[model samples]
Target chain A: MDWISLILIPAIKSLILVIVLLTGFAYATWFERKLIGRFQQRIGPNRAWTFGLGHPIADALKMIFKEEIVPSYVDKILFVMAPGLAIVPALLIFAVVPVGPNITLFGREIPLVVADVNIGLLWVLAVAGVGVYGIILGGWASNNKYSLLGALRTSAQMLSYELPMGVLLIAILLTTALGTADGAGTLSLVQIVNMELPWYIRIWILLAFPLYFITMLAETSRKPFDFPETENELVAGFQTEYGSIKFALFYMTEYLHILGASGVAVSVFFGGWRGPFVEQAPILGVFYFAAKLIAMVFLFIWVSASVPRPRYDQLLRFCWTFLFPVSLVYLAITAAIVILL
Target chain B: MAVSDGIKGAVEIAKSMAVTLRALLAGPLTVQYPEQPIAIYPRFRARHELRRYGNGLERCIGCMLCEAACPTGAIHVEAAENDPEHPVSPGERYAKVWEVNLMRCIFCGDCETACPVEAVVLGHEYELAGYSRDDLLWTKERLLEPTRPNVIIRTE
Candidate 1:
């Protein structure tokens, strides 16, 4: 194949992924509102065009038209770049996600993913890790003491949780290795997802599901783990100095990150695009993927409304003392089971 | 041991099923707001409507007090001098340009209470559903007194 064709394939796939991810992020906000509204016994944004589908558009328009204020003491360049930095990694992680099976489009067999490198899982982790830089940089560059304190708290929280997140992946890796024919392993998400196993092993893996899920929630800085931008302590946190479109970018990125995290969780645990009855149909894979993602997104919103934020000490203690040890034990148990069996 | 395990499992299953059974017997919780109307609270602040006096004269004196009280700046009002030829109310001035941006309004009831003459009041018709931003922006005419054949008693 020519280099041009190779480059064009990924470029086109990435463009489609961007459109789908952005649209999904927009609707995720709507989904959160509607679901949380019902939970709280109120009707949400139902008046903004066809069951409130246009609420996001209305919000975007308002943000764009609103005045952009730049504080005098802030580092102007970093302040401007922070939101883009936050959003870019969020958009990029979706490129590795497989939405469906290979399909022949225009007489060419095209994979459902934008990029399917061997180290796809690692690529996701690395991209997500870099997203924290946006928060840290935005907070520091603002020259506000509260912003700096919030950034410090966020950095520590993310760092503490990331260890357990990585350790939990080791358990997943062990399960994948045992399911394979040879003792060797393939860490590609597609290959791992395709591995079949008995109920005993499947149940064991499912037990660790909550660990990864909670860590993902913390990684995204969502409620219950949302100390970074706690409105009570920090006034809008890192984005305090940002306004208008800049602030909109940060808001959009938060939604996108939640979507990306949910996508990864579904792919790893729930079997990406794999349904009980629809595995044979390639097109149904997309439906299965969407359903799983929506369920995970709903869980995020439900938990946000139902749970209260943990104190800073509690958050750190839970991650380090509870999650870290449990994940480490899970890895050891899985490895022992694999070796002995 | 087997009997105990069976009894324990049955008890757990029944406990979960009891919740579903109660929900099924309790009837539907949904009110179907559009199809079947529900009673609104007496103090509920819904859509704004200009109140009329006993003699059918408008209560608003074009003070713009509601506009000033709005936290979201949703209300817009312009006062024009009332003339003997085309007088809108008994007051010296009347609101020529009155608009409420429903999109921005938080519906905090501050605007209704700010009215000095008790002209602006939130009604019980809470269904302020709209299809677009323009639809949400209630103009002076849409917000004026109800012009129907039958006259009803106004509840405070």
Candidate 2:
């Protein structure tokens, strides 16, 4: 294949991914508001024309039109660049996530994934790691007491959850390796999904799935694990000094990160773009991925609405004392079983 | 707080999930709002509207009962001796200055209950929004109805 086939096609695919993802991020806000509003026995934002569907567009417009205020005494450079930093890594992680299986378009066969890197799972974790830096930077740059506190909380919370998350992934990888008879387990995400029954679905891997989910929820800074930008204490967290489009950027980054986390979960545990009739009609893979992603998002929002934020100590304690031990033990057991069998 | 507490917590989470699932299937309890208008109770205390007597005279007797009843101290009434030539209120002393800072008012219906002559009634008009706090202060002029405009007032 020439450079056009290798480079140009992927560039086009990445462009499409970026456009779809940005649009998805916008509507994700509206969808979450609507669902969560109903959960609380109240109607959500329905004033934005056409069943409140235009709310995201309206919000985007408002953010753009609003004044971009930079307080007099703050770290000017980092404050300005933080949003971009948060957004970049979030977008970068999607490079390996395939929306659909390979298909022939205009007589040219192309893979659905943007990069299809062999170490896609590692790439996801690496890129995700960078996302926190944005929050930490934004929080520190703001020079506000609350913002600084929120930033530190985010750092601690994310770091704490990540350990258990890694353990769970390790267990999952072990299961994948053991599941097949022919080959050693693959690290490529597409291959993981392509497996008929992912290790997470098996009875042995069942325990790992829920723990992984909790870690993901915590990592995303959702309601249950939310301490970073909690409304009552932190006063909008790291983005306290942020306003206008910059504030909107942080929000967008958070949502995008949520999507990334959900998609990763879908790919890693639940079958990603792998469902009945996916191979026969490859386009259906996109729908499968989307449906799973939506369900994951719904679960997050539902949990967010139902669960009240725990005390700060309680949250950290839950992770360290409970999740960490359970996942580590599970990983140890699974690894031993895989090695033995 | 104990070992049982953790199990109880687990059960509570499941119970919460069941409740949410039930709520989801039951559909959103939210009204479609403007398209399907909200049905409020007839006795619902909302915006305050001043009333007038059959003789087309203001019903306020300038008694500071409503002012005392307001929990937020929103009402300020300065009563004056009514002009015999043109008596606005039925009593000798009428409220020359009637102001209600809605920002402070809690719409507790206490003022409506406290009014002796029923001059001030909490009516169904709760679209109170403005850029400034000054706009929220409902004056006597704004509160009083303008004789229903072109409608003929049949004097009993």
Candidate 3:
């Protein structure tokens, strides 16, 4: 029973999670292209099948058959390993994310997550923090100037944005914890989602939403803050030296990271899997969770499409000068309110 | 900058996003050619062709004005006396040899204008790709009986 509960179920969940994430990563590209195309008044990828549904398959085939090129005078091992490093953390970040409530399968109750650890939120933060290593190492190993510059930019950007994002999340957690029946705060994401909060606290947390949104965008290295891989200057940044499947792996990491970030955002803000008729039919919770996740991703894409990328100095200055102070003020305000209430 | 400036910037971004959303609703400006018939002007000059009168007599008098008028020297004409018993054209002389090197033709419509009897015309069959240069060297026979259908939209 212990083996079935602890190891077998989790292993099955992890396998399913990876398969779903990979497929999501593939189609996310298609969705982004189609949506951005519409935004620009252009039809995107209608050649293969209706509305280019088979585009991802065609792209995968192209990537697989492409010749892998390893430049001379490059650190071959780290260059090869960088993409793997980048993708592993991205995939791992989703492990703690509860997609839906516990459901009975084969006469056994199972939590719809790979891991529901007590320190689930901390795990997400830590795992997300590791994603930069892939970019840094990839850029460093390429033995190219542009790659190194991109890597350097990435490290700086991460350092600047991580603080506000962490602070905003802490503020949110404080509000959620304080508003609950018991004063004891929990770091488990599922518990946070399930907590019932009063209107004042919900409104207070909503005040922190914009800062969180900006930080999340910067953290994911999406457009408008994508200085690390800006095509104009970096020529694909860290991925300059990578080609074929290796390049595809890096591309997969970028999209999968977006999915993970969006999933976390949904759980933290949108009340994960909580919807009308969801409690009665737990299966509907999965659909709600998926719908929320897609909506979050769409918001991300919409922001990217709307905003233009800032200059490197401007990006850093915006983070340090504006975002950092604003979040600090927010955190101080939240702490004071919690103490007073 | 002031807080008001920041608010203004946010408002501007919202406006731009609204503009883009409106564009999204306007549908794509793409012309899906080959599947759909494209609208081209009636005067759109594309390929050269020879013409005939109602009586089926060739309109060309072999004047060679088109060859002179052609800026690229894409046209060539040779004239010959028509047979007394059966005239190839209403005029005494008819075109013995006429060819247009499409490789050099610029589709300027000068040849159409230069012809005294309106023997030459630019048609609406512009999909002129061929495997070799020889295929594009339209001779008298080819120009006299063009196989492709002309598609011209009369704006008037």
Clashes of each: 0, 0, 0
Docking class of 3: medium
**Stretches > 4 Å off in candidate 1:** A3-5, A276-280, B1-156
RMSD of each: 11.1, 6.8, 1.7
The clash number for model 3 is 0
**Candidate 1, B90: how far from true, in Å?**
28
Fnat for every candidate: 0.00, 0.33, 0.58
For model 2, the superposed segments whose C-alpha errors exceed 4 Å read A179-182, A197-201, B1-7, B28-156
Answer with 2 or 3, whichever has the higher DockQ. 3
Residue range B1-156, candidate 2, lDDT tens digits: 354655678788878877876776676777775566566665666778889899989999899999999999999998999999999888999988889999988999899999999999887776678789889998999889643222222333
Give the CA lDDT, 0 to 100, for residue A324 in model 3.
79
TM-score of each: 0.72, 0.78, 0.96
Among incorrect, acceptable, medium and high, the docking class of model 2 is acceptable
Mind giving the per-residue lDDT tens digits that candidate 1 earns over B104-135?
A: 98889898888989988877666668999899
| Residue A241 lDDT in candidate 3 | 95
Clashing pairs in 2: none
User: Candidate 1 iRMS, in Å?
Assistant: 9.8
Ranking by DockQ: 3, 2, 1
Please write out the lDDT profile of model 2 over residues A259-318, one tens digit for every residue.
Answer: 999888888867788888977898899999999999999988988877778998888988
